[model samples]
Target: MTTPSTAGSLRSRAAESPVDCDVVVAGAGPAGLMLAGELRAGGASVIVLERLTEINPLLKAGTLNRPNIEAFYRRGLLPVLRQAQQETEWTVSYISSRRSDGTSTLPRFSGHFAAIMLSEELLDESDPDLAGLNPPDMVDLVHQKQVEAILADRAAGLGAEVRRGVEVTGFEQDAEGVTVTTGKGPIRCGWLVGCDGGRSTVRKLAGFDFPGTAPEITGYHGVADITGVQDLGVGWHATDTGVYLNDPPRGRITTVAFDGAPAGHDTPATAEDLQAAIRHVTGADATVTGITSLTRFTDNTRQATTYRQGRVLLAGDAAHVHPPFGGQGLNLSVGDAMNLGWKLAATVRGTAPDGLLDTYTAERHPLGAWVLNWTRAQIAVMRPEPHARALREVVADLARTVDGATYFAKKISGISQRYDLSGDNPLVGASAPDYELADGSRLADHMHDGRALLLDPTGARHDLVAPYRDRMRTITTAPLTDDAPAAMFIRPDGYVAWAGEPGRDSLDEALRTWLGAPVAYPSQTPDVVAAQR
Candidate 1:
């Protein structure tokens, strides 16, 4: 990474803040950083504004799901992810503990591919693009702090300006662009993105209303760095006391909801409470550790009414929050960042119509609602009651089967969740389609750019996609046999928005809906090129 630079120069107005940019992200967290990386990769000039002086690399978010690993790879986060593995101590065994002698057990895990049960269908059916990037050797564990540093560094390296210790106070947008007021000063930009924490300052300042279903929830948490907790294994523990353990590499982040206060209230936590809970559940004199941080909170199970509001868009915690049932928050936030980044870039660069920005909400809002629903379902099913525990145990038994394991792993990883977008044919907005290459290579190889790919089935699929080649990253794969159909249309968000025997009307509509069907490619014809020359 380049040497750290101050937010702006005090000597000159132009030097201190950018007069204009393709995108301006508020809050340089993972969502902001990942989005900045994506925009920069797509050739957009981006500015990322972070409020905190130093990275709050601690407190939460330890597990990286299979889909998240795939997203990290898409946003140029593979290297950091690789580095993150070095700091991890892999657990040979993990058990999702419960009361009355029942637990969800996974024997082995290393990287992207877990022994967990959620991915059997994809693997057994030989899904080509199911992201075979992780193995037991690399990804089951890592430090949250390290990940923050890496993503922040990658964002900076990719040409996005990231400024920490700079708070975004407010913003105003005109027909052309937006002007953001910050602690450093006022900076102008083409667009704004709010990736701030749950109580996002950007969302609040934008005057957008947040509406969603209330969580049937209450919760408390403690972040402790107790030693010897290692090799105790990884994963979560739902106890009869209405608490759960988030045992990550750094420490255990225990959260439980007992008394229903506000949806989110941070009450102080103490040693006595934890020790009592531990003894009550494990039947042992528990070893204690230093209290890094403690909080009491209630699950909101709420999502923002909309993702984009005029010039400012909310992402990550700013957009949604719920029980950490599936470890969905981080992955979903990453998805939010990836979805909005390219749209803002395209609009700023004038490749897409202004309406392109509207798709962000249309595509992601429903997905956010889905995650909230799943969390609520998990909360209800995980009440620490004998019946709930027994049901979970039954599910675990099913997980022992190959079919069951893959489903559980993939679902919990959030990789299985894809948005239902209109205009997408069978394969348009679907997960990366894994097809064979004539050269005997994997289909995922061609998806390196993180853009939508038009896969040619008859190899003739290329002829259809060639005209808009520059607008979309079209690729050629093996011929479609009876096992697979004709061609498949893949969308950038890794979902099959549309697919099937390629037809003119649906393809036209799908293209138009997603990419504004990029009116033209290269923005220059041979005649125009000659004229310019």
Candidate 2:
């Protein structure tokens, strides 16, 4: 192992030389920082650049969906996030319709789609289809800043260098490496990843074609001192013109106006502007005395034509952008980072199999498109037109049903997210279940090191995995679940790469395909080594 001083010297030398590090990630948000930590855990040198000198306090995402929750648990960051969640206060309200008698009914579920309440009663907790889908506190409502802070701390602890106030202006990639031009200076790296926000300078400069639908409505969020208005109880309300939500604890007010008008880019929103939007959406005379902060958003959706362009790649909002209707934006971006981190690290370390890096695009593009389409579907039903209103009513009725509610719940929580991979077992492309072993260790407890896992419940695959011990971990334990197989190969991102009974030919192929060919041991003779090779 190299000493810290020696490592610093090597980095300094590399900085002055052609390449500065193995990977240079642009942006220091949750996606970028999470990727940085993952790459560092995978033994790759990473440099994360951020345009902002200081961390922003704004809370963009108020909740972490099921997928992100499991991801955090896998990384051992869930405990930290839960601690942060305790320190932060959030006002959450369930949205539903009012009865004719003026008494409001409680929603059957905690989430909504196009203002329709998704009923939790439809979800059978004991069903096999829902296995590994729900974790403790399935939906965590933590502030976005808190999440970023946790990720940044983890990345730094893992030895990733994060530099603030360094803006990436452009980049040029050749067959050898990429030369990134930033506001400070130029830095060369083996690969570049853009985790910038929606208005990604890297995406624009790198010439990635972003194609999607235009904005359908202008949305507003603000915190203002108000008076002379009847307290519209906390929750979402859909009117003839649009939708508005008010949660008094945080002095929060939100509105979605369907006039198809975009907010001015240069002009900052004021109290008067927010009041007008609220009045239009609620048909109530609300007075705004003072505004703390006001911002505007839109349903303008766009996705990169491809996630990768040679040695340069994109993740998070830089790769895809859509309206944060069901609060899928942050979750999607974090999932992108988790999925790309290990693959990119492998590529940088020269251990990636054929087409390994390309699989990033293959696996993520469709997921991005699915999210974009999901948001678009919500916008369609939320439209103020008569036809859309009629459709929304129909959807509301269906959402109250068992099947409709379960379907929407699955989609909203991301429990149904499964990558398309070649496998006969249904669990192959799904997230691995956190199985508890006889020794009291859980599956996630073994994944924090960011290495592939070969779980052998029967303890018969030790010989098969011994050759790749450096890159893979073999856990010997009894079957923990009724659906547990004799063996399972889990990737670094917690996705199952292969699963079956022991002594299958496909198992060896999967080992070589994902973890690369095994190294020969010193005990092997020359003829055996040559034959193995």
Candidate 3:
């Protein structure tokens, strides 16, 4: 018989096992794979533990937003992703107006908020507030699985050890390191990161507090063959019961019903279950003949009260979750990985500045809260109540206007998000634009190696930056704009760290602040110097 004392002894023995690697990442989704690749590039050993034995082929998110697309390009993975999957042009159809002649005109939109269209024509690229940025071609569509496959390939090529069918059951952390207790065994590491989706075992085991609102409505998404189905056409539709959408090409059907009860994640949704949801939302007797994949979601918004508790940190959906509205979940999670990867890697390498790791939560928590509130507002506008319908109409009208559409477009595309970093420059906290150098090379062309970039147009800061060459890359280039600064400092994640005329003291301080102290040069001994002379 296994008594309490014996079990405790076994656990203690397991915890005393040898250290595994520098970092152990829980879950092998996009976030985990991306982090693993980044950590590998930054010279840290990583082990990714995933419970799933194989990749899930189900189509969850169908498109990548502009910011995520730019991230992929910055990493030189865009071409590889294109080679692996077919690219399709995508457009956001905001508000189509029917004229008196019964003809409708399609107004081009970058995206939408709460079903209200954000127009592309309304965006002024030259506006300083908008940072002279234009959304990428809307027609680019890539499958979620394709993205995961590409990331997995990249991570494996970089020598990250990925173990499948391994579940992290518990963990214990102290000042020295963390011991992750998994089904296989206890693996010690300098750090443990939870990238494990919404119901993260790592988060729960670490005793992180997740507090948020309960789900207001139950949502369903399924791909199936239908029989005796009425053609509701393709696009979002709001009915008296709730909402429903049908896409014939993809053989996809989706519905949202305000039933006030959440679905069980353990329960496998059947064809009949999807049929019932369809009937309830559309009030149509559509019979489902087969179900390829059926899943349930909710607006159960939640976020970790803190991202890091000791050495255990959280990222991606493990840190925050919300309704997958406007396809922001994947984009937000990818952004989280990008932001956390370099910082965590530096922390493991002991090269990070003071409070650098703390900035992960400081910067990302507000962004996560914004996304959660964004989805919540969408849900409120999409409710079946009369007030919601009236408000939706008002929002639709506002979305058709130029200013309103531009604002929404910026928000939805993530171009408008600016971190509250300490800088007066307009581009400091914004996404770095693809600056065109004098040689016709773009900024992304030089960022493939994942190192900080220092662009000096006038070549004045060459001596000042020589000390930090090992930690940063310096380039001499013509000014990107007529009023552009003489020099600019860009972090590894492609955010402007500092921008101004080249000043020795300021540049040195900025380098120390972002890239850690410069490597010390060993002085020559007196005898060696005399011999050389």
Best by TM-score: 2
TM-score of 1: 0.75
How does model 1 fare in lDDT? 0.62
For each candidate, the alpha-carbon lDDT, in order, equals: 0.62, 0.80, 0.76
The candidates, ranked best first by TM-score, are: 2, 3, 1
Q: Could you estimate the TM-score for every candidate?
A: 0.75, 0.90, 0.88
Tens-place lDDT per residue, model 3, 466-531, is 666655677776645687677788888888888887578877887887767665545311111000
Off by over 4 Å in 1: 1-18, 75-80, 90-140, 212-240, 244-257, 261-287, 291-297, 384-410, 422-425, 457-467, 477-485, 502-508, 517-533
* Displacement of the residue 313 alpha carbon in candidate 1, Å: 1.0
Stretches off by above 4 angstroms in model 3 are 1-18, 85-109, 117-140, 228-230, 522-533
Write model 1 residue lDDT over 1-533, tens digit each, in one string: 00012112211333444456767888877788878877876677888888788887445566777666766654445565665665454322332222233222444432221112233333343544334434222443544556677778877888889888888888887645579898778888767888887888888888767876565545545667554344433555555556455456545556454445542244455655655545554344565667765554556767788887776788888888776655678778888887877676666545554467787898888888888877776665656778767776776576666666665565576656666656434443556544555565544455555566666544544444555555566545454345554656666655565667767677666666655544334533311000000
CA RMSD, predictions in order: 8.5, 6.7, 8.1
- Point out the worst 10-residue segment of candidate 2 by lDDT: 524-533
Candidates 1 and 2 compared by TM-score, better number: 2
